[model samples]
Target: MSELKLNAIDFISFAVAGNTFKLKANLIGPNDQFHSVNLDIAPDEIKNKTIGEIEKLALQALRSA
Candidate 1:
């Protein structure tokens, strides 16, 4: 399969009760189309993570989808 590329990330919302943040991941598909994925993540999940690391995660999610 062709590699998926991470395009951008947008903040959707935060659930204070659950302590989770919602994010919209924008990716470039293998066919050059844009794909959007919504991810719910805890703040700790991204703490101290570099941009490259986060990009890798996004790409992995795209591939799985």
Candidate 2:
């Protein structure tokens, strides 16, 4: 499958109780269409992760959608 291109990542909010993060991802689909997706991330999920790694995760999710 073709990879989705990540255009931007925006911070939406944080849940203090669960320590979860809400992010908005702006991506370019494989067909060159633009898309915006919301993602819920746990602390463990992002620990020591690079921006590229996060982008890969978003791309994977978008491809499966």
Worst 10 residues of 2 by lDDT: 1-10
In the range 1-65, model 1's lDDT, one tens digit per residue, is 24666778887688899898787877776668887777777888856767667667676676688
The C-alpha TM-scores of every prediction are 0.68, 0.69
Model 1, residue 32: C-alpha shift (Å): 2.6
State the lDDT of candidate 2 residue by residue for 34-62, as single tens digits. 87777778977767768787777777777
**Candidate 1 displacement at residue 34 in angstroms:** 1.1
CA RMSD of all predictions: 2.3, 2.4
Q: Can you tell me which runs of candidate 1 are displaced by over 4 Å?
A: none
Which ranges of candidate 2 are over 4 A from the true structure? 1-3, 29-32
TM-score, cand. 1 vs. native: 0.68
Alpha-carbon deviation at 52 in model 2, angstroms:
1.2
